[model samples]
Target: MSTPVGGDETQAPQSRFAGITAALRYPDIRTLFISTFANQFGQGTSHVIIGWLVLDMTGSALLVGAAFAVRSAPNLIVGLAAGPITDRYDRRILMKIAVIGLMLTALTLSGLVYFDVITISILLCGVFFLGAFQAMYMTARQAYVYDIVGANRAISGLALIGLAQRISQLIGALLAGTTILHIGGSGPFLAMAIGYLIGLTCIFMLVEVGDSAPDRQETIVENLINYFKALRSNRLLLSLMISTAGAEILGFSHAVILPILALQVLDVGPEGLGLLTASRFVGATVGIAGLAIAGDVKRPGALLLTTMFFFGISQIVLGYAQTFWVAVTLVAIVNIMATMSDVLHQSLLQLSVSNEQRGRAMGSWIIGIGTAPIGQSEVGLLAGATDSKTALLINGASLAILALIMAALLPKLRKL
Candidate 1:
């Protein structure tokens, strides 16, 4: 793979080139990458389709926010348990089971929609199940990456997955919107279900590649206790987890306000909303590509802080934009910043932790990422009372404040 300019010999691979090369180099990574790309493409499309469905159903921003909240609520409730469960099973098996569960759930959802029995309540209920399965699946998947590539190559592997997901999102969003416009919401739901099935098939064909040792014999309670004990001893990990949680809280919370911003502030429609969302993927793709080329830049902490600062500023810009095009541009910038921050945070967390506890650690890491809907609920309430733009401005300012505090407290992060 050719390296990017200014990158070390090992680090110089162009993000796009490197991702493909890395995937090709490792069979296990390639399988996981391909499966996840398919899953995310469907998922990205489903997100837009579902959100549009809810909005069309109720025309209430709160309901849309509630839909997102329902999706995330399971993570807050069940996320902590996922880590202990993942540690006790073969991650590959766990992922397969999770994917199956998701497929079934999607099938159930499609049945309702196909019968014309779907309602907001039904959708929300289905979303809850999907979210629960997703939490477990994500925990297992993150851990599995480490098993496939080892820690040294983990960041590269993650970048590749991110790249795949971004590209999928870009394609999926446009595809979903167009599909829904012509075929109704059922089309997207069925497509997503099929995608999950494909992902499951891919996993079945995969040959597990690292750490095939039988799991240590331990009671569930024993594993839970050990995980807590480990967490207690790792202050850096704890701090990193907290910082990660805070960032996600700030970021995902915007989902509640964004619909309102589109409908009221920017006066845009579903197409505009799709465009705005796609712009984020575009920015993310660029950011991921940049990072792949940069390859392990020093001072990840500083990069994190700077990226977050940009994220906050971009949100504020998004809130203030008067036209649809401007909103799309601001969202793109925010996505770029967010993509870099996400990569930096993941790399930092992976590098900071020990191998034995990686699954548990990453499970904890996602607890923060997954709990954003709770914060979004609060933002939704505020938006309900005030204007969407004001709510966004407030959230943006809060993120800026948190980023500044994090930067000051974690000097090491500043260097990165």
Candidate 2:
């Protein structure tokens, strides 16, 4: 069979382009790329604003974590149903509605903030709705990339998409911090609303026909059963999902406590928090771009494991960082490894699964990611009990230890 980028056997040699720019050859993929950047930009902005806003309101680490938890908790609720819906419907249509929902949610939040009437309850409700839309939008987006590019180039396609997301995040984080400093919390929400609207415009421009028939026409319960059966049968996919959850729970969840680090530990204020967040994305963008330019990987599973090992070490050191610059350096290293691991995880899953089951497979992946709330909340609880640095040190050391064990045990997964 022909590859996603390579047209046919006759053109195989010519289609071996090393650059990620090759994915842009498809018009619809281009639109997807732009829309992804916009969505991530809004998220990047929210990442900064939400933590600071919560901290400002309750002055408690637990509440800050709870605020972010509420945002992602919806993924647990809607993640299972998202895949089946994506598989049964046109992903393009799903994306259109999802983006609209995100825009309205952001706008409503902005209005509440501007009027100075927003409460924790109201913010959590808005975040929950936003998370629900995001869950569906991202699942469809991942599957839609497969529709544009096939499995052979899935890694490269996802890497480039990650690159775009990181770049937008870099910009969004920096802008959000500056905006919040000058205009308060309302500014970031207004900016997020605008970003979602721009994302909707890009989605509207996508011309792909995204409808597809499922492999089986069973009832929803039957389909859910079959999905679990498939996961059980495919040990690689199951292992990958487990590893993803471990990484998220251990390493990536430190994002929620960064505001505390900025305020109490580093004493750099909101601007410093923004810089720290932007630094992470800058490193992520570099790692993803390097992977994209390298093209096809010979040992992606091994690469994922190796990167994760370093990620844990970075997290460990970040816990002990006493200076702002020191924390920034550690965050950069942590994100580079984190981004590589994520791309590898998604690529391997997409390559292993069939198109009909792609949405459900990714839904399972989302559910694993949803475990971030547990990790984040733990960090908050620990930080409140002790110190932010101590919380991070413990989290990081645990992650590294777990990653080592997973690598040693999952030889089958390592080979892929």
Candidate 1 lDDT at 107 equals: 83
Q: After superposition, how far is residue 173 of candidate 1 from its true place, in Å?
A: 1.4
lDDT of 1 by residue, 1-416 (tens): 11122333245556546634653466676777788877767667666776787878898777777888788887765667877777677788888998888888888887788788998998999888888888888878877776665555566667777787788888777677677767777777788788888888877766763652224535568867877787798666777778777777776577566567666667676666667667778888888877765555666777788788778777877777777888778777888888887777777776676665566676776777777776677677777788777777887888888889987887765664
Highest TM-score: give the candidate number. 2
Q: Highest lDDT: give the candidate number.
A: 2
Off by over 4 Å in 1: 1-20, 211-219
Model 2 residue 368 distance off true place after TM-score fit, in angstroms: 0.6
Count of residue pairs whose backbone atoms collide, per candidate: 12, 0
Error of 1 at 380 (Å): 2.0
User: Using alpha carbons, what is the TM-score of model 1?
Assistant: 0.90
**Candidate 1 Cα lDDT to native:** 0.73
Clashing pairs in 2: none
Worst 10 residues of 2 by lDDT: 1-10
